[model samples]
Target: RFDMAGVGDSELVEGGLLYVERTRADVVASMDALSERVDSRRFLLMGLCTGAYNAFRAALIDDRVVGCILLDGYSYPSIRSQIEHYRKRVFQLKRWVDFTKRKLGIDTPSGSAVQGDLVVFENEVVSKERFAGELQSLIDRNVRLLLVYTGLGPLSFTYRRQLHDAFPKIALDDVATVHFYPAADHTFTLPGHRQRLLDDLDTWLADEFESETAARG
Candidate 1:
């Protein structure tokens, strides 16, 4: 996928929340251009981390987006998730081994951060009700969602079905597709983890849109 303005190597230009307006405009422009040359108008948006949040907001604003693939995106604080996260951390021998290595300066963990001052990012303050509302709106528009979380994500998303637990009132557990890879970090640092992510993505893409020749914008 192409980078939104102010992202990647592109020159930074600030806009509204999460740069939604600029991103929306850029995406729509690309969609129009793509549609002129392609047979289908429907679109799918797949993004990671901040890109995922941007894609999600863009989908809400644009009806052409038929589906979204969100990786290591939004999640909220919940007791169950906290328990699960710490429980695994405390019980897993590998976790302690890795921690000891880091503590001993034998292993330095790689970060998934963009070294720049142009764009500022903080945790999004999205309440459960608001998030549920937005999700329902997308659902009403027939936008299929594939939500995936990695080990570096929020504690609340430790389990595959925790999305529902985070928002029990929503029917997302039954409706939305969710996956979790506890071994994978936010950026899939390991080769095996990256391959697993690609494999899962391929299967999801095939299962959802194999019959339709749609543009993935």
Candidate 2:
């Protein structure tokens, strides 16, 4: 639950590529400090959106990161996901209402999904081959993962199992734990959505590492 620099309780800083780099450094530094202070050898990193990317990159460089819980992380474009994503929302009345509001400028999201103050970061996905190689390398090292996708704009993460469909070359069927929640928004704003996510987290952590943690404790 540590807040890295440029985020809550830390010195505010400009967002963008620089912010991404800063967080990567922060994650490594935090792990290093934790290793020295608590005599901890292994760690699990969790991040949301861009932070997830940072944690993932850090895991590649540091073997100490044994697991990650990535929420709304890198979502590659998939025709299948796109069709299903649009199909689910196109018929929904709420979608029409929200579209109308945006068209009329009644409730516009900040930055319009492009470069702007709030949207300093774009939903840029790494190349499929490159990403597959990187991810497979991590898997080869036995890095455990929990990937989650919600009803963030289709551009962010449209559906659950998007990761599997996006990268069939990688044997993620058994390697990763994935969950999707189409009813929840990007940030899990609804109480029900948040509760569901928390419950899932509890279950995942317990199943994956509770025994090891208890033995250490």
Best by the TM-score measure: 2
**Candidate 1 global lDDT:** 0.75
If scored against the real structure, what TM-score would every candidate get?
0.74, 0.76
Go through the candidates in order and give each one's C-alpha lDDT: 0.75, 0.78
Error (Å) of candidate 2 at residue 29 is 0.4
Q: Which regions in candidate 1 have their CA more than 4 angstroms from the true location?
A: 9-18, 85-124, 154-156, 213-217
Model 2, range 1-217, lDDT digits (tens) per residue? 7777867887754555465577777888889899899988999999887778888888988899889999877678577867875686689886587679878889655545322312323334478788889899889988889988887533446656678878877888655899989787778999999999999999989988899899988
* Worst window of 10 by summed lDDT in candidate 1: 113-122
Runs of candidate 2 with Cα error greater than 4 angstroms are 12-19, 85-125, 153-156, 214-217
lDDT by residue (28-88, candidate 1, tens digit) is: 7667878898855788988887778778878888899999999887776467877976786
